[model samples]
Target: MISVRVNGQRFQVRAASIVIHDGHVLLHRAADDDYWSLPGGRVEIGEAASATVVREMKEELGEAVTCGPLVHVVENFFDIKGEPNHEIGFYFQVALSEGSPLVDKARSYSGLESDLRLMFQWHALLDLGSIDLRPAFLRNTLSTIPLVFSHVVHPGADDV
Candidate 1:
């Protein structure tokens, strides 16, 4: 909701959740997207990043989650629809609250955001390299969560 365009490029601050169970990690993607990413949303004005993660999970999954420690802070630059964009992302550890049905769901499912449908799934940590998970660095970071917080910068296509 805090997205803005500056100098013809989009800028946003996003908060994402890292939810892992068994050997799989939870991820979601818009129906039209070819890649999957963490299940969180833009950081709204006046809301803490952690709070955004909690709020997003509820709104997207219809389930309450307990926000945990900050995991990673990423300055991610990328392109969307061929338009350059910049985003600062806060990745937080999270867990579904007790008695939430989604905790044990093994198969992929759909969640709704207004009229848009989002696909949610649990992917085996060992198989992340095969998926087009965004930020690219996450393919390795998610597999071995750092003991201390980490800050990462993912260069955009032009910078590569």
Candidate 2:
């Protein structure tokens, strides 16, 4: 959870999960926020990106996940609470561990993480264009997901 300051802005390294099932994708938004995005958190020092996804899932979803191959590598520059922020994100394809009820249900559900009060939900993949997913690039990329991993660069967020 280290934050580095670069030219008065903040930079971070994060890992995200792209969990899809039955034509839907799993997304989460903080309780006070208005947009949806992948579920994951910052990568801890010394932790592998893949492991970060696994740990974040357990913390945010209260479920175990098995991370598959990395699908997208993104360099995102955005602003949070008026502060410029940048993140190097690793998006990995993931799934609920075997026997998890979520795997069987494959429908939208909401829950508040006890500590953060973050709300996790499932959204139909077909409707992603209407949602506000940060890094913005994802809005288009998710529809025709590439079989091979891709590199993405989001110059910056317009909200700044």
lDDT values, one for every candidate: 0.89, 0.81
Which digits, one per residue and each the tens of the lDDT, describe model 2 over residues 30-136? 88899888988888899999999999888766788999999999888778888898889999999888777775445555555555677677777788888898767
Model 1 residue 134 CA deviation (Å) reads 0.7
Error of 1 at 88 (Å): 0.5
RMSD of candidate 1 to true structure, Å: 1.8
Per-residue lDDT of candidate 1, residues 1-160 (tens digit) = 7899988999999999999887788999999999999999999999999999999998988888999999989989988998888899999999888776776656787899888899999998899999999888888988894435889889745674
- The C-alpha RMSD of each candidate to the native structure, in angstroms, is 1.8, 2.7
